[model samples]
Structures are given as structure tokens and as C-alpha cells.
Target: MDHRTQLEERIAHLTRHVDELSEVVARQQSELDRLSRRVAMLMAREAERELDTGGSIPLADQKPPHW
Candidate 1:
């Protein structure tokens, strides 16, 4: 193949690869956002449980047993 033709093929291949990678990254970002929201909700529920049990320390502020 001619030099110009080879260059064009390489460019096309790279472009496709970049597009595929972008889609993968976008999917990961969406999944991460969903997981983050779930974690926050779970944390809130734990805090409410602690309050109902009459625990004064917020779960986040409490030190570990080793401390």
C-alpha cells in the first residue's frame, strides 16, 4: 500500500480504539456514581440506627476499638 493509504488506515484504527475506551470509561463512571449513592444511604441508615439505640457518638467520629 501507498504511504498515505497506510497512514489513513492507522488513523482509523486508533480512532476506533479511542472511541471504545471512552465508552468503557463512561460506563465505569456511571457505576461508580451509583455505588457512591448506595454507600451514602447505608451510612445514613447506620447513623439512624445508632441514634435509636441511644448511642451518643456519631459512627463516623467514633474511634476504632484498638484506639
Candidate 2:
């Protein structure tokens, strides 16, 4: 009930919240790294496919008909 006790409780709660958020950020970072690698792999595969098809320009670089 004292001021000092209330401050200590608030500090404890804030510390716990910060720790939880840090863990969540770490998990998100790990997921982002995995997704980035997967994207790179997919891009490489697509580039190979384009080359095999003997395309002069990549499909991604081609303009759509609506353009």
C-alpha cells in the first residue's frame, strides 16, 4: 500500500512486459529470416525457368496488356 511498494510492483510488471515483447520480436525475426530465404529460393527457381524457356526478357519485367 506504500508508495515504494507500489513503485516496485509497477517496475516488476513493466519488466515482465518488456521481456515478453522481446521474446515475441525474436520469434518474428526468426520467421522473417526463414521467409526471406524461401523467397530467394523461389526467385532463383523462377529465373532458371525463364532461362530454360529462352525468353529474351523476364516475365516480371514485361508490361501487362492493361499497361
Best by lDDT: 1
Clashing pairs in 1: none
Residue runs of model 1 more than 4 Å from their true location after superposition:
63-67
Point out the worst 10-residue segment of candidate 1 by lDDT.
56-65
Model 2, 1-67: lDDT tens digits are: 9999999999999999999999999999999999999988887788778988997776756789899
Poorest stretch of ten by lDDT in candidate 2: 54-63
Quote model 1's TM-score.
0.87
Error of 2 at 58 (Å): 3.5
TM-score of 2: 0.84
